[model samples]
Each structure stands twice: as structure tokens, then as C-alpha cells.
Target: MLVYVLAIDIGASSGRHILGTVENGHLALEEIYRFPNGAAMQNGMLCWDREALEGHILAGMKKCKELGKIPASVAVDTWGVDTVLVDHQGTPIFPMAAYRDRRTEQVTDKIDQRRLYALTGIAHQPFNTVYQLMATPADVLERTHRCLFAPDYFHYFLSGVMANEYTIASTSALLCAGKNAWSKEVLCMAGIPEHLFPEKCNMPGHILGDLKKEIADKVGFNCQVILPASHDTGSAYMAVPARDENAVYLSSGTWSLLGIETDTPVTDEAARAYGFTNEGAYGGKVRLLRNIMGLWMLQCVRHELDDRYSFAQMAKMAAESCYPHTVDVGSNRFLAPASMTEEVKAALREENKPLPKGEHDLFRCITQSLAVCYAQAIRDLEKLTKKTFTSLNIVGGGSNNAVLNQWTAKATGLPVYAGPAEGTALGNCIAQLIALGEIPDLPTARQMIRKDFDIQEYLP
Candidate 1:
């Protein structure tokens, strides 16, 4: 009998429900529903529409039922760091603030970045939950009964269960270095109450509970809600089909997270100086990665042009153009820029570099700069981990860009294997499969992925 699993993989810009099945030692996926997701200006702050997202989740489940493919279990994975605070009555007390909101900027400035990194082993990001919580108003904090990360909140919505999943919680900058528990010292330092979080954190693959009766009746199906590394990057890393320990994984999407998997967290001064973060991975591993500003630059550029050109068209133009201008793609100035084109031009002018003349040149500049940044990150990873990685596995939506893949290969001087564009959903499904006994372990799941997906290779 074939068993089905559902993966609700939500990113910063979009969300999709994928129904997956494992048969004949291979995995297959069918996207049941997709919806646009973005932070919108509300009450003078950027926030997520929790109700709309909840409605879409129910609609997707109903669609699955209509297709006669009710999954044996369901899991959700989303971008990390953003969270919502629920009151004693299990009601959200404030709007869900997005990670891009500037409310935490002042708070970050007040905290000691180096000390915070030593405590949490997470790099300093202005949008981290630690900063967000510190910026919360006193009245709001007093009423907040529990603070749940994005995926945890959604899982709570489905099962009425309140618990933080380990992987997502690791991104909070509140979890202690090399530990599965929250850091009381860090919380106290930030003046965040200890009671704001769940009493305990659950590891990935833990079955939280069955779907609530109300939701089951509405969707016409009842299944366990399993935790799948609830952080989207964690799930995406789970889908990397690496053969051995000598492989580096890049979960390329809105953010390009490139790093190696390690059994222990890297919390030394060098790691911190390199801006590397130690996030939890499945089965008690640590993802020692650096977050590079990825396609967001190109995304902003496309948006600035009112999306006059499709991504494919831009990629083709970038491949043909001969622009040599490059800027630090990871700079804070590129984050939530008012105008990406103007920002790039400004940076070029300041550096006394040749300015991009047209759309093609601008696209080329972004792509080439990203590849260079990736190469630098790879060098840093090797130096920190003391491991030479022979291959780079590029997974997620950004892996679909052949032009960028080739440039990455050339820049890094390493062979690149790019495929499984739906890596987050695939990894989410695999976690559900593991919980359902359809797969034995992560290594076996990766082997099955290798058999199922066609990975295109680019040589240096």
C-alpha cells in the first residue's frame, strides 16, 4: 500500500501544499495548492496575514481530500525567526511582525552583538527573534502567554498544541550554544520573560497531535501533525542528496544558506567573525552555514521594474551580458532597499566602478556578484570546518537558474549539482514519511531522493 504525506512548505514570498508518495523506492510529489505570501504594511508596520494563511492551509487540505489523496500525516516548514505571541486564551495579542520590520533595529543596537553570538551561536541579524522580543512593548509582553515561531504557530493552529520545534527554535538567537534547550541567561540579558516560550522544545519528527476535529471536519481528513525541522532552510537541507561527508549544501532561495553539516556547533571567535551561524539540523546535527543575500537582490530589481521581465528572460539576458561590476551583495544596504537598481548604482558610484547601463547589465552584475559571494562563503566554510568539499549541492528555487549555476561553478572552481527545486517541500514530506515508518532514516531518504530526482550538473 502506498502511503501519502503532505508538506506545507511556506517561504518568505509564497507557500505551497505538496502531496508526496513513496513507491518502488522512489519519491514523487504533486503540488495540490499554492498561494502568494508576503508581509504587508499594516498599522504602520510590516506584518503577515495570519488569518489568510490559515484559510489557505485549510483550503489546501480540502483540495487534497477532493483528490482522494488524504495524507497519512502532515508537516509544515517556514522561514525562521519571525514569531507571534499568543495570550492566555490562545489568541494572538498582536499582529505577526515580519523579520524585515525595522522595529528590532534599535533593540539590536542596544545589545552586544559579539556576546549574543557567543551565547546563541547564531550570527547577529537585526530581525532575529531575540531582538524582536526585546523591542516588544511592556504591555504586550505582559499579556503574551507563549511565543511561537511561524511554523510552530501554524502547527498550533492545526492541532491546538503548543510547543516549539527544535530546528526552528534554534534560529531564535535565544537557544544556548550546542544545546537543545533555551538559554535562560540570554533571555534574561535581553529582558525577555522566560514564560513567553513553551515549557519544552520538541525535536523534529515528533508527532504533536492529531488534527483538531473542527479542522478535520472542515477538510474531511484526520492525520497526525508531525514536526519537520519546521525551519524551511532546515527542511531544504534535509533534501540535499549528498553521497558522503565531502559535500557542501546550499539551500538557495530568498536567502542563500551555504555550509556543511557538522555533528557539533561551531562557536569559536573565527566562526563568529565569519558571520557563520550554527542552526540545529535533523537527528541532532548542526548546520554550520552563512546566510548570503541571495536572489532577494534580483527579486527587488525585478520588482523595481514592475516585473516587466520574467525570471527566465532576465537569466538569459544575464548570461549574454558582459558586465564586470560587482558589489558586496551581503551588505545591509541591500536589505529591504527602497530601489534595488538605484541601490546598486549608488554602490557602484561610491566604489568608482563602471555603472550598469541597462537591464541586462544590471542583471549580469547581480548574478556575477552573487556567484562571487558564494565562492567566498565556500572558502570560509572550508577554513572553519577543516574539510575540503569536492562538490556543491544547490537545492531550492534558485537552483533552477542555469545561468547562475554555471557562474557559481566557475567562481568556486567546484562541480555543482543543482536540482530538486522543490527541496523544502520534499524534505518536509520525507520527515512525515520517517514519522509514518515509510522511510528508515535521513540517509535512506536522501538515497531515495537521488533515485527520484534528476540533478543537472555544471562543471567548473
Candidate 2:
């Protein structure tokens, strides 16, 4: 008998409900639903539309019922660092602020960066939950009851179980790097009450419960609500079918996360100086990674082009162009830029580099810059981990760009394995499969993925 599971993987810009099943010893994924997602300016601050997202979640579950495939378990994984504060009655206290919002800007400087890094092993990012909470108004914090990371909030909405999943909470810079628990020292520094977070941090693959009665009635069925590595990057990394221990995993999307898994967190001065973070991974492991401004520059550039070309067309033009100039793709100027195309031009102008002559030239410049950024990040990872990675696994939607894959392989001087574009969803389902007793363990699931998926290999 075949068992089915669902993974509702939500990213910064979009969300999808993917159905998963093992077919003849191979993992298969099918898209059940998809919806556009973005932060909109509300009351002079960028915020997520909670109503629309909740509605879509229900709609997707209803679609599953319409298709006659009721999953045995379901899970959700989303981007990290952004969460909502709920009152005692479980009502949202304020708008769900986007990580890109500038509210945390002033608060970040007040926090002791070195001490926080030593305690949590999270890099000093302005948008970290610690800074966000510090910037939040006193009245709002006073009324707050529980803080729910995006995925946890959605999980509670579906199951009426309010619990914090480990991986997503780790991204907040409030969780201890070495221990699988919240760091009270960090929380106190942010002026947030310790009780605002869940007392016990739950690991992924544990069952939250069946969907609430109303949801089950609306969707025509009930399924166990499970937790997958609730941070999308954590889930994405779980699906990497590494050939050996010496392979680096890159969860490439709007943001590019490049790093390796470790048994312990790296929190030394060198790691901190390199801007590396020690985030949580499945099975109590640590994901030591650097967050790069990834394909967002490309995405913004494409948007400025008024949707004139598909991603494939842009990649083809980029591969053919002879533009040799490159800029720092990880620079802060590119983050939330008013005009990405103009930002690229301005970055080049400041550096006294030649500017792109056309849209294709712009594409070439952006891709080249990103590849170089990836290469440098890999070098830094090697330095921090003291292990030389032989291969790089590129996953998520960004893996589909063949030109970028080739450039990455060339830039990193390592073999690149790219595919399983729905990596986050795949990892989310893998946890459910294990919980449902359909798959034995993560290693076995990875082996199945390697045999089943069309993983394209590019040589340097």
C-alpha cells in the first residue's frame, strides 16, 4: 500500500502545497496548490497578509480532498526570523512584520553583539528576532502572550496546538547554539519575557495532533499534523543526497544559504568574523551557514524589466553575454532596494566598473557576481569547518538555472549536483514519511532520492 503525505512549504515570495508519495522505491512529488506571497506596506510597515495565507492553506487542503488523496500526515515549513505575537486568547497582537522592515535597525546597535554571538552563535543581523523584539513597542510586548514563528503559527491554526519547532526558533538568535533550548541570556538582553516563547522547543517529526474539527470538517478529512524542520532552509538541507561527507549543501532561492552540517556549533572568533551563523538542523545537528543575498537581485532585476523575459530566457542571454564586470552580490544596498536595476548600475558606478549596456548584460553581471559570492562563501566555509568539500549540492528553485549551475561549478572549482528543485517540500515530506513508518530513516530516504531524482551533475 502507498502512503501519501503533504508538505506546505512557504517561502518569502510564494507558497506551495506539495503532495508526496513513494513509488516503487522512489520518492515522487506532485504540486497540489500554489499561491503568490509577498509583504505589503500596512500602516507604513511591511507586513504579511495572515487572512489570505490562512485561507489558501484551507483551500489547498480542500484541493487535496477534491483529488481524493488524504495524506496520513501534513507539515509546514517556512522562511525563518519573522514571527507574529499572539495575545492570551491566541489573537494576533500586531501585523506580521517582514524581515526586510527597517524597524529593527535602531535596536540592533543596542544589543551586545559579541555576547549574543557567544551565547546563541547567530550572526549579528539587523533583522534577527532579538533585534525585532527589542524594537517592538513596550505596550505591544506587554499585551503579547506567545510568539509564533510563521510555520508554528500556521501549525497552531490547523491543529490548535501552539508549539515552537526547534529549527525555526534557532533562526531567531534566541536559541542556544550548543544546547537544544532557548537562551535566556539572549532573551533578557532583548527585553522579552522568557515565557513569551514556548517552554519546551519541539524537534521535527513529532506529531502535534490531528487537524482541528472545523478544519477537518471543511477539508472532509483529518490528518496528523507533524513538524518538519520548520525553517525552510533546514528542510531543504535535509533533502540533499550527498555522495559523501565532503559535500557542501546550498539551499539556493531568494536567499542562498551555503554551508555544511556539523555535530556541534562553530562559535569561535573566526566564525563570527566571517559572519557565519550556527542554526539548528534535524536530529539535533547544527547548520553552520552564511546567508548571501541570492537570486533576489536577479528577481528584482526581472521585475524591473516588466516581466519581459522568462527565467530561462534570461539565463540563456546571460550565458551568451560577454559582460565581464562583477559587484558584491551580498552588499546591503541590494537589500530592499527601491530599484534593483538601478542599484546594480549604481554599485558598478561607485566601483568605477563598466556598466551593462543592455538587459542581457545586466543578467550576465548579476549571475557572475552571485557565482563569485558563492565561491567566496565556500572558501570561508572550508576555513571555518577545516574540511575541504569535494562537491556542492544546489537545491531549491534556483537549481533549475543551468547557466548559473555551470557558473557556480566553474567559480567554486567543485563538481555541482543540481536538482530536486522542490527540496524544502521534499525534506518536509521525508520527516512525515519517517513519522508514518513508511521510510526507515533520513539516510535511507536520501539514498532513495539519489536513485529516483534526476540530479544533473556539472563539472568544473
Q: Candidate 2 — worst ten consecutive residues by lDDT sum?
A: 192-201
Q: Once model 1 is optimally superposed onto the true structure by TM-score, how far is the C-alpha of residue 449 displaced, in angstroms? A: 0.9
lDDT of 2 by residue, 1-460 (tens): 7789999998888999999998788898999999999999999988999889999899999888999999998999999999989999999989999999988877787877988999999988888999888888988988999999999999999999899999999999999985778888888778888778767789989899999999999999999999999999999999999999999999999999999999999898899999899999999899999999998988888888897889899999998899999999878888898999999999999999989999889999999998999999999988877889899999999999999999999999999999789999999999999988889999999999898889999999
Question: lDDT per model, in order?
Answer: 0.92, 0.92
298-332, model 1: which lDDT tens digit per residue?
98899888989988999999988989889999798
Task: Write down the TM-score of every candidate.
Answer: 0.99, 0.99
Report lDDT (Cα) of residue 15, candidate 1.
Answer: 95
User: Which segments of model 2 are wrong by more than 4 Å?
Assistant: none
Model 2 alpha-carbon miss at residue 35, Å: 0.7
Error of 1 at 417 (Å): 0.4
